[model samples]
Target: MLDAVLLILREVLEAALILSLLLALSQKLHLQFRWSLIAVTIGTIGSWLLAHYAYEIADAMDGTGQELLNAALYSVVILSVIALGLFICPLAFKSHLENNLTQKKIFASPSGKKLIYRLCIVIVSFSLAREASEIWIYLSAFTHDTEMLSSALIGSAIGAGIGMSLGASTYYAFTFMQKSYFIPVFLAIITLLAGGLSMQIAKQLMQIGWLDSATPLWDSTFLVDEHSWVGELLYALIGYDSRPAPIQGIFYLLTITPVVSACAWHAWQLRVKTHE
Candidate 1:
């Protein structure tokens, strides 16, 4: 139950942060508020539909078929996490689209409204795609048990609601707080979370034989089993695994360290540029 709650919190927070950033960008650009809200609504609905389909597919498999399905789901989770970590990090730091949108004065025209609506639709589709991909991966992990499924679904819904509210509040707070200071801090938190998730994905892939080399770099399984509260907390926050394979360890270091360093450097450059 605690694990389920933690999962929901992390995933929901990630989605909320992404949506909030996009919404904030829209506001900065002086985009039509109604159209933006409509886009978000469409995106949320589309994500829920995709998650439902994933759950249905998982429910229909059994025995060896179930094993195969789980493997596939794990693969999807790893791939999606990698893709999102790569794509979102750069965008968070160096999004020029928002700046371009802000510069446009034609939004006051009738054709501009039409263009904005079309743009909003595209944004909605893209956002939904990202969210759906993540949600599907998450659902795939625990779709086997009836009780777990129920808990995950209910917890995810509640978490998403709370996260969205928190995100909105944070955005409003930052409006008065100085975006120059807030942006890096926000990006740092996200980078850490993504880095941790990436490590977990690498570990999962190695465990399921989807990846090569299954030797543990250091067997810490003796210290607080992952089911324990301390272990679970570490796992949720920092991707802590007691018995991680060598390849998993290598992948974690290779993938997360470089990406996080690059992100930090990029954010620094952006800050310098903003000041200049």
Candidate 2:
């Protein structure tokens, strides 16, 4: 039961965090949650399909198919996250500068709103599909063992409840922040989240022998136990690993640099426009 809880919690927490972030962004943009509903439905079906075909998928690409597929999904997720940050920062900053919750002039266009809506949907759908597929696969493995199956199911429920509750708390915390701080906070979290995902891609590539592995860059487990609740939260928020490989750090930096640079440039442009 404990093993099941931890496994399910990790997967559920990841999806929950991503969904909560994107949903919070949607609210900030004055968008409806209709896209969220569609995304959830698509994600549920996708997870079932992926889990149903797991063996075939694992068999493909000379037994490296699963890693390759996961890498592809992670890449898509990272790119989508970067795109969201790049697109939303300016609008959010504009709203902040105007000192309004709704940027009427900026939010006037249906196209802009639709684009953001679609991005959020894509992020949530792909993220949920990837993360929840693991849970589905785990639960399916114990189907023949009724005794263990019941325990796994109960553990999964508890894990999912805890994960969702944490995610909701995060969303509400964001809602309570002042507008001036929200833009930076949102962008920082988005950037770090994308970097963490890129680390996942690096791990997948390494597992498939596509990328060279290296020694651990550093170990912070002495300061914070990786299995603790705080560690789990950090992992969900930023892909925190106590002893990440050097390649993971490299991937993290590579992903973060461009996002930071782009956001800085966007902020600069916004400042210049405000002055003009």
Candidate 3:
């Protein structure tokens, strides 16, 4: 039962937080979130497909197929996130880009709006598919154990409720924040999430011996027990790990550096223009 609760909570919170952020972003932009329905439907189907083929996939590519596929999928997500970040960066720091009419038109144009919506849909669908398939696979294992299955179902429900509540609270908090802080805060959250995901990709590659493993830089379990509720929340929110390898940090930095560099460059450009 405890296992069920933790697993469900982790997956639910991860997806819920991401979806909530996307919805909040849409609302902030004065755009409709109707596309979420389509994303959910597609994601549901994807979850079933991925779960159904789990064994076959694991058996392929010299038993490294699962790792390879996960790495590929994660790469897609990270790239999509970077693209989204680039798109939003100008708007977030518009005080600097205000004189650049092209940047302004990018937000106002219908094509730009479509691109944003499409990116959000892609992120949500992939995230949901990846997360929900794990739950499906786990729950499917207890089909023969009626008693255990019942307990698991109850635990899952409780976990889901808690996760949804937390996610909603996060969304409301974003909504309540002053407009000046919203975009920057959103960017920071996404950056942390993306970096954490890149760390996961590093782990996945290392599992297949594609990426060399390194000793953990430090143990943080004393500060935040990875198995505890707070740990779980942080894991879902920022991909927190109690013992993180140096290689993982490298992967994280590599993934986030582009976005950070671009933002810095934009800020410098803005400073120069201001001085002019």
Candidate 4:
């Protein structure tokens, strides 16, 4: 039951974090909540449909279909997050861009602003869809055991409460930060999430023998089982892994390094231009 609680909490929190961040950004731009609410409704319906077809989906591609579907989701999530960062990063530090031609932030033009708003809807939709699918699958596993089902229901309620509280906390925290700090911090979080998704996609691929998942770099299962409450929370927040494969670790680091370095370089260049 503890395992179920932690797992559900992690999945719920993942979506919540994405929605909370997007909601905070939208509030700043005066974007209507209707669009976001519509997205929430659509995602909930879509995920339920997908969950209903889970057995057929899992049976596809010689029983590797589930992994493939997960990989595809990671791809969607990866793209949406990166695009969201591109749109938000500039607006967060508009003063940093100097030239009139280049100074037009994503939200400067009507079309561009609409594009950002739409992407916000998409990112939220995809994030929720991904998490909802997992939660549905996880809960469905306890249908046979009445005791487990009762325990799971209790666990889920508590898990959801914790997850939502964390997401809300993150939103409020961002609201209190200075713009200079906010942009970089926001970008960093987005980048980290993207990298984590990439690693997860790789893990899914490995399940089908498409990529090497030969050995763990180091085992931390002794320290904290990922099924534990704290470990599961860390997994959602920062991509923690107890028995990370070398391939996953390598690619995860590779995925994050370039984005972080590039963003840092651009911020530095902006600082230099400001001085000049």
Candidate lDDT scores, in order, read 0.56, 0.83, 0.86, 0.77
Candidate 2 wrong stretches, greater than 4 Å:
92-106, 270-276
Which residue pairs does candidate 1 place in steric collision? none
The best-first sequence of candidates by TM-score reads 3, 2, 4, 1
lDDT (0-100) at residue 196 of candidate 1? 53
Sort every candidate by lDDT, greatest first: 3, 2, 4, 1
Better of 1 and 2 by TM-score: 2
Q: Which of candidates 3 and 4 reaches a greater TM-score?
A: 3
Which regions of candidate 4 fall more than 4 Å away from where they truly are?
Answer: 91-105, 144-147, 271-275
Clashing pairs in model 3?
Answer: none
Q: Each model's TM-score, in the order given?
A: 0.49, 0.91, 0.94, 0.87
Q: List, residue by residue over 1-276, the lDDT tens digit for candidate 3.
A: 888989999999998998888888787767788978888898889988989999998999999988888787778778888888888776666664363454558767889989988988888888888889899999999999999999999999988888889889988988888645777788888888899899999899999998888889899999999889899989999999898889999989998888788788888887887789
Runs off by more than 4 Å, candidate 1: 1-7, 21-46, 55-161, 213-245, 253-276
Candidate number with greatest lDDT: 3
Clashing pairs in 2: none
Per-candidate RMSD, Å: 7.7, 2.3, 1.9, 2.8
